[model samples]
Target chain A: LAKTTQPISMDSYEGQEVNITCSHNNIATNDYITWYQQFPSQGPRFIIQGYKTKVTNEVASLFIPADRKSSTLSLPRVSLSDTAVYYCLVGDPYNNNDMRFGAGTRLTVKP
Target chain B: SAVISQKPSRDICQRGTSLTIQCQVDSQVTMMFWYRQQPGQSLTLIATANQGSEATYESGFVIDKFPISRPNLTFSTLTVSNMSPEDSSIYLCSVEGTDYGYTFGSGTRLTVV
Candidate 1:
């Protein structure tokens, strides 16, 4: 199982672009980086996933470099409601069943 | 994409009692995962429920304490047996989505007093 490490918490103001990075030193060849957003008292929602390069959805964008040892999740013009815990998971969900979650970063967007 | 409906959204149970949480998926999935989240902490994987087979538990988790049942592909149940105050946490169920990510249920907030 591949383990991920990210910051415990982050502070950002409204309308600012926030970037949260996760480092997976032992990432596998078939592992894909996936990011999930979780609100209080609710389940996690899938934000974006990428195997390599960059992947952008309406909600967020995932950037992965050539080394694939780390990935970043970028939130553009974050709002107060966007404040939540963001989890970075590294695994091959297509072929593996051991999908584990890291400590995650708690992003607090202030006014 | 799949939708999961988990029942008994929040419950307060007495100690030494068992609570069975049910999860029903809108579509069939190969595996259903169960997770636990303590207060102010991250999520922890409990076990993987596979249909017609024994559930695979992670380290520090045992089947005797958390018995899982997967009678079919669309539904599964997890019973937290002989609950204690330490077992009070948010229990969630998840399934791998057709997309690259996984879909999780809203979770069951269990409080054992």
Candidate 2:
């Protein structure tokens, strides 16, 4: 399992874009970068996932560099409802059932 | 996406007593995982529940203290034995599918007093 590091908290205004970066220096070649959003008292929701380059979805986008040591999750036009704790995980989703979660980045979208 | 329904969404248990949390998935899954999350902290994997077999627990967790059972592919249970105030946390069950990323139950909030 690869350990990830992310900001403890971030503040963003509504309608602005927010980017949370995660560092996984020990990421493996077979590992995939996944981001999950967790609201208060709810399970974490899958936001986006990518192996490399950029992958965009209806909710967010994931950008991974060639080195695979780090990845960034970009949320466009944020709103108050989007405020939540975002986790970045890097691992082989198939083989590694033991997923380790970091402290996560708490994004606060304000008005 | 798979829907996981966990029982006893929230419970207040007395110290030294035990509580069993149940997780039922809508579809069959190869693996089911139990996790514990302390308030304002990250998730900690408790064990992996395998169908018709014993569960593999993590380093800090043990079967005697946190027993697990997976009678079938779609159902599992985790029992917190000898509960204490330190055991107060949100217990979550999760499953992964080929198409779906990962689905987690709403979680069981246990408070020991």
- Local distance difference test, candidate 2: 0.91
Model 1 agreement with the true structure over B26-56: per-residue lDDT tens digits:
9999999999999888899999998999999
Model 2: interface root-mean-square deviation in Å: 1.1
The numbered model that scores best in DockQ is 1
Per-residue lDDT over B31-103 for candidate 2, one digit per residue giving the tens place of the 0 to 100 score:
8999999999988999988898789888999999999989988999999999999999999999995564688
Report model 1's interface C-alpha RMSD after superposition on the true interface residues: 0.6
lDDT (tens digit, per residue) of candidate 1 on A1-111: 449999999999999999999999998898888999999999999899899999999988989999999999999999999999999998887687447888999999999
Residue B45, model 1, lDDT: 97
Q: Candidate 1, which segments miss by more than 4 Å at Cα?
A: none
**Maximum-TM-score candidate:** 1
The CAPRI classification for model 1 reads as: high
